[model samples]
Structure formats: C-alpha cells, structure tokens
Target: MQEKDKLNILRHSRHDWMNVVQVIKGNLQLDRKDRVYDILNEVTRRAEHEAKLSDLNTPDLAYKLITFNWQWQKFHLDIEMIGKPIDCARHEMCWLKFFDQFFEKLTEQSDSMTDPNLLVSFHLQETPYIEFDFQGGIQDMKNMQEWLAEWKVSSSCYVENIVANEQELVFVLNKK
Candidate 1:
C-alpha cells in the first residue's frame, strides 16, 4: 500500500475508535448504566484493535506484525507475540507483504470456523538481524511458505522456513 493510503486508513481507524469512546462517555453522562457498560466494552475492544495498528517508530516489519495482530483481534481472534524486539532492514517491505496476506487469510479462515476455541498467534524471534518466529494453523504455514518462495524469487532477502507444530510455525529471514 502507498504511504498515503496507510496513513489514511490509520487515521480513519483512530477516528472510529474515538467514536466508540464518545458513545461510552455520552451514555454514562445520561445515567444509562447498562448502555454505558455495553458501550465501554465495545470501546475497549476497538481501542485494543487500534493499538495494534498504531504507528510504531520501528520498521515496516514491526508495523506489519502489530497491524496484523490488531486485525486478528478485530475479528475476535486471539493473538500472541513472543520474543524481544528487532530493528527493520532494507528488504522489510516483502516481509510486510507476507504478513498482510498471512493475517488476512487467518481472519478469513477463523471467521469460517464454527469452533470458538481456535486461536492465532505471531511469534517473533529476538534477534538483531532479520529473523522472527511464527506459529499457528497448518494452512497458514503452507500459505506463508508459498508467499515466501514467491518473494524470494523476486526479492533480495532470503527467508528460511522452520517447523510448524499444532500451535505455531517458525521462520527466519535476513534483511538485505
């Protein structure tokens, strides 16, 4: 996405979240306790979602992961992040593309499932270089690998795929 488009989406997201907060405040002032409480819960959910998409001073990869987490949360899917932190590299944009597709498909599949116990998580490997971890559904693993291969053929960075268990998938990458 273009920088302008991303900024616009984020701006709109902030506005939408604030609207929810205003609803809660207004309902509380009216002494509608039940409505206030209901609105407050919704606001909390939206605020959490916004936080994930909030601008980070780090690289685009970090932003992608954070936004992906938020997207999953908005869909009512549980998301977890592991590891410390890492800086972004030059070839980070490809990673963001992979993450966008990853999260999009995850939400899509999760929404279709009848089971409420399903959860999706993005695990990050703490490294100074370009490396991270991932764990989640089996289908997600396959889709990510495929995207990585396509990215590698046209990109400069190399991404290594690791094993994925029932709970997560693991991978590493180098920023060119």
Candidate 2:
C-alpha cells in the first residue's frame, strides 16, 4: 500500500474515534448518563474485539482487514473476532490468499448502486472458522459461486455455502 493510503486509513479511523467521543460527550451534555454508559460499553466491546484480532499473529491478514474500508468497494466491511484469540501464524498465507481472491470477486460481482455491507467474523477458538455474511446484490452470481467452489475444491480449507443468491451470500470456511 502507498503511504497516502496508509494516511487515509488513519484519518478514517480517527474520524470514527472522534464520532465515538462526540456521542459520549453529547449524551453527557443531555444528562443521559445511562446512554453514555451504554455507548462506552459498546466502544469497549469493540476495542476488545480489535485487540483479539491483532493477537492472532497474522499481520498481513490483519492489515488487509483493517484497511478494507479505505479501498474502492461498494460494501462496508465489518471484521469481528469471536472467542479466544489463537495463533494462526502457520495458516496466515492461506487465509490471506483466500481473502485476496474472495475480495476481488466480491467487488467485481457486486452492485455498485446499492448500499450493502459484508460482515466477516473470525471464530478463532476450538473448531475455528471464518464466516462471510454479505447482504447485498451480486450481478454475476453464478460466476461468484463457481469461483468459491473452485477455490474450495483446490484449497485445503473446507467451505460450506449456506446461501448464495442475489440478495445475500453467506458462507463459512474452516481449516482442515
């Protein structure tokens, strides 16, 4: 990534942090202490998730996900880390390579006019797996599914697509 792109990501992250602080401040001004506490708890929960994601020992994967919002994609990306963090150093490349291709397909097949979001959750505890939950429209649905199936067949990871259609595409990947 270029230095400019790196700076842009920092700017975006800073904006989000500012928004959080503003919300908290606004609630305090309104004397809504309960709402302020709720917001703080949510912010702390999200921070914990981010810390767990960083603890996975997958720097490339972490960078890809952390900077995903800076890219030119139609959908917003949300990355979540669930359960205890596990060291995934041995499988970082495999996971990174898979997402590199998967993201391409997501952008190429997605509808640019619609506002959609993709939630990617990393289940890192026992029976670890990655979940892809996309809510949006895909232009070339068949091609996307074929690409996923091809990758699954050729790769060591196991993939199960629960739903693949125009409105949504949900799948899970687990190392074998």
Task: Please provide, for model 1 over 1-176, each residue's C-alpha lDDT reduced to its tens digit, 9 standing for 90 to 100.
Answer: 79999997788678767877788788888999999877778656545643442322345555554444344352333433334333334335655665566556555443234332323333334332333443334445566556656645545555565555655545555444
Query: Over all chains combined, what TM-score does candidate 2 have?
Result: 0.82
lDDT of 2 by residue, 91-114 (tens): 788788889888888888889677
Candidate 1, residue 60: how far the Cα is off, in Å: 5.0
> What TM-score does each of the candidates earn?
0.40, 0.82
List the RMSD of every prediction in angstroms. 7.4, 3.0
lDDT of 2 at 76: 89
Question: What shift in Å separates residue 61 of candidate 2 from its native position after superposition?
Answer: 0.5
| Global lDDT scores for all candidate models | 0.51, 0.84
Candidate 1 whole-model C-alpha lDDT, 0 to 1: 0.51
